[model samples]
Target: MAYQQQQHYQTQQPMPTMGMQVGGGNRNAAGKPLDSNGKREWSHGLCGCFEECGTCCYACWCPCIVHGKNKQRINHLAAKGSPDPDGGACCSGSCWGHCLLTSFLGAGWILQCINRGETRGRYGIEGGGCGDCCTSLCCHSCDLVQVSREIELEEKSFGQRY
Candidate 1:
């Protein structure tokens, strides 16, 4: 019963990681560890980079998920108006939810590991659930803005070369 309540509190409470701090208090930028909706994925931030790629949607800062050639991982779905699948990037004409990291990391090593791309997708919209139904699993994730920026630079370089 206590465990159940702990979980309930966890769910309802604002969960934050080590480095992610928000307002003047001990909260995150949004006053909560998780996003407003408590759901985060590839594009994590004020918005998610999925179904579209403006800000957080389709954007990623987590490490690269290695996929074999011609590998079909996600059962890609087309939302409204997206684009083509260049690197099998969660294509719904846009970015599908990517395995992303939320803002809170437990240990210092965890933060280092994230910087080094050792662990990926431990937070945010986890596709893996409690083995039953998908109960909107929301957790503190990393701000992959740095990672997203890096991708943009690479793309720009690639374009210049091509």
Candidate 2:
């Protein structure tokens, strides 16, 4: 009886196929599958800023909040997991100094902008309809909403790529 049960279990196991999607999973959610050039494109264009009304409005009115949230989400996705998810030094332990810099130097946006570049790198998304620094500096609200949308829409199936 033991030998028979062992054989039954062994035969019941599912076989792993090469490149076969196991369960209606999408490996190409980030736009088209990798081309011969080996790059994946963003599912949505940067100019599609108004695609998400809530994100656009939030980014417009509360730029800092939008940037902070985008930074956190990007960090989480890029690192698989990150302790400093907010990308804020205060939250990561250096409270007073970071607070001072934010208040006086006004450099908090730099971290968020860096994360935007990181997100572009991860998905091979192109930059420079206006360029990263200019987009982050001049049209920050639009850039924030666009980045948030890209991550939200495209990252749904990203983990399975591994």
Candidate 3:
């Protein structure tokens, strides 16, 4: 039965595939997962122990998505001023402070939805609001804020089409 228990434990304890879990088995009532260590590293909706840490920040990965090339350049730039970028007295244990770029591309989903003169949270929110729903579903039911229907279009080059 020891072998069976070990195998069961292995399957029950999934590891991080994209980001870190921060803490152990402190799952929510809905079993949404927890960050017992409170490292706040955010996950890719995976429920695993704190040990299987993920490098990418699922919640605040703006820098990764927007500045993909810049990130590679930063990493490729042969070592830096310090043995580790975030090691000074002013620095925390993590290099998050050293990233010289913004993370998420969107300011806020709610703001974008409002600015677009729309309702419903169709676009996924990055931080406070906004997300990736193509339909204008996020703005209609909102009562706290209202946006006018008139909107101006900004023209851009071919590269900005996407």
Estimate TM-scores for all models.
0.23, 0.58, 0.14
Model 1, residue 104: what's the lDDT? 39
Tens digits of per-residue lDDT, candidate 1, 95-154, equal 221222223332222222333231123223323323111111221122333233323322
Question: How do these models rank on TM-score, best leading?
Answer: 2, 1, 3
The TM-score that candidate 2 achieves is 0.58
Which residues of candidate 2, in runs, are more than 4 Å off?
1-30, 33-36, 81-109, 128-130, 158-162
Kindly list the per-residue Cα lDDT of model 2 for residues 61-127, writing each as its tens digit.
6566666666666565555532233433223322333334546886645544676787677555655
What is the alpha-carbon RMSD of candidate 3 to the true structure? Answer: 19.3
lDDT of 3 by residue, 22-124 (tens): 2221111122232453322122222221222222232134322212222222222213311112211222222232233223433234332332322111111
**What is the lDDT, from 0 to 100, of the residue 117 in candidate 2?**
81
Q: RMSD of each candidate?
A: 18.8, 9.0, 19.3
Q: Answer with 1 or 2, whichever has the higher TM-score.
A: 2
* Candidate number with greatest lDDT: 2
Q: What is each predicted model's overall lDDT from 0 to 1?
A: 0.27, 0.57, 0.23
Ranking by lDDT, best first?
A: 2, 1, 3
Candidate 3 accuracy as TM-score: 0.14
